[model samples]
Target: MRRGRDEQGQVSLLIIGFAGVIAMVIAVVVDASAAYLQRSGLDTLADGAALHGADLGATGEDVYTGGLPEERLALTEPAVRAAVGDYLRRVGAHRSYPGLTFTVAVDGAESVTVRISAPLDLPLRFPGSPADTTVSATGSAVSTVD
Candidate 1:
């Protein structure tokens, strides 16, 4: 009739359960931190791409309006696209993750925008195809009339 011996097993079970919970919490913390870093990086990439594209567009407009009538729209669009693409690739979106996509568009003569998106796989939450998150930036610069 010794109650102390029986209580020892219960203590062990509780300890094991607490340890498992602690491990799970640590894993969650690490995963969340990594996701945050990835998100931040993507945001920077989007901003850079948009700004570069916009600069190109704005410059083209300035050149054309500054008595350069021979400059065609096709040349401007391609230059913007190439600049955006180069920025995106250098920023690791095209090389790092396969679930990322970029969309760049020329919005008129003085504006350009770039959209960057990625699908993140987050476990311990609703399970399914992860939701796609997108970050976009638009920049506009106008030519000053002399």
Candidate 2:
């Protein structure tokens, strides 16, 4: 049997290619799962923060206690931001997610929205995977009087 130069290292090249592909797949899966899980956790946290911003924000306690001075309920921008910040600090969100950033928005007088973002570190450093990425989640809440 006669062997050509092309055939000599063909098997080795195929093995290396397959190995690279497998490593890339693993990296993608791990990083993707991490991002997804972080997003889910952030969603829950954002929901809680939104609720806190709406209920414990400026004039929030007064309204809940039936002590509002005005006929309508209103959520002030500064108040909502402060409330969300306090809530996150109390819950240790900053400690849990390093480099966490958040924003609070008031949708008129009835709704408060909380959006949180954080940098995600990849567990696996593959050829195409970024060393760091960002994940974010948003939550909103409305105040109602019965």
Candidate 3:
């Protein structure tokens, strides 16, 4: 009779443990999904900035040329950087992602590259798990006018 009574409450403990495990799994899934979405957003922003930079034509160029001139289509480092900065500012990317950092550079004579990075805070805390994770993405665009 005492053994049966002891076993009756044991199931409750087992149920509680199982519930804890399930909760932890759910937390992990939610946090992971959030991080993935944040990364995707950063990637999209970088791609847009890079494409905008690549589309900027060189200054003081003659559009009357029968064929596309290399000088007009060239991607300069200063021009690429300026275009990328302007785009980021216009879109308020820094305001959207606080503590975000980015870099813009000319990948080649006709290509622009942009890299953006931000930190994501996890929704749940766990033993030995980082409180925040760094997410970064790089995008490149090539000028086709040449």
Give the residue spans of candidate 3 off by over 4 A: 1-5, 57-72
Candidate 2 C-alpha lDDT tens digits along 1-118:
9875666778999999999889888888988898899999999999999999887774655456766644446777788899899999999999999999998889877799999999
All candidates' lDDT scores?
A: 0.62, 0.86, 0.80
Q: C-alpha displacement of 46 in model 2, angstroms? A: 0.5
Q: Which candidate leads in TM-score?
A: 2
Q: lDDT winner among the candidates?
A: 2
For model 2, the stretches where C-alpha displacement exceeds 4 angstroms are: 1-6, 58-72
Clashing pairs in 3: none
Task: Give model 2's TM-score versus the native structure.
Answer: 0.85
Q: What shift in Å separates residue 94 of candidate 3 from its native position after superposition?
A: 0.9
Q: Rank candidates by lDDT, best first.
A: 2, 3, 1
Q: Which stretches of candidate 1 lie over 4 Å from their true place?
A: 1-5, 65-79, 90-92, 105-111, 119-146
Relative to the true structure, candidate 2 has a C-alpha RMSD (angstroms) of 3.0
Q: What is candidate 3's lDDT per residue for 39-126, written digit by digit as tens?
A: 9999999999999888863431433444466453666777778888889889999888888888887755677889999988887877
How do the residues 21-65 of candidate 1 rate in per-residue lDDT, one tens digit apiece?
787787678667767777787777777777776555445554656
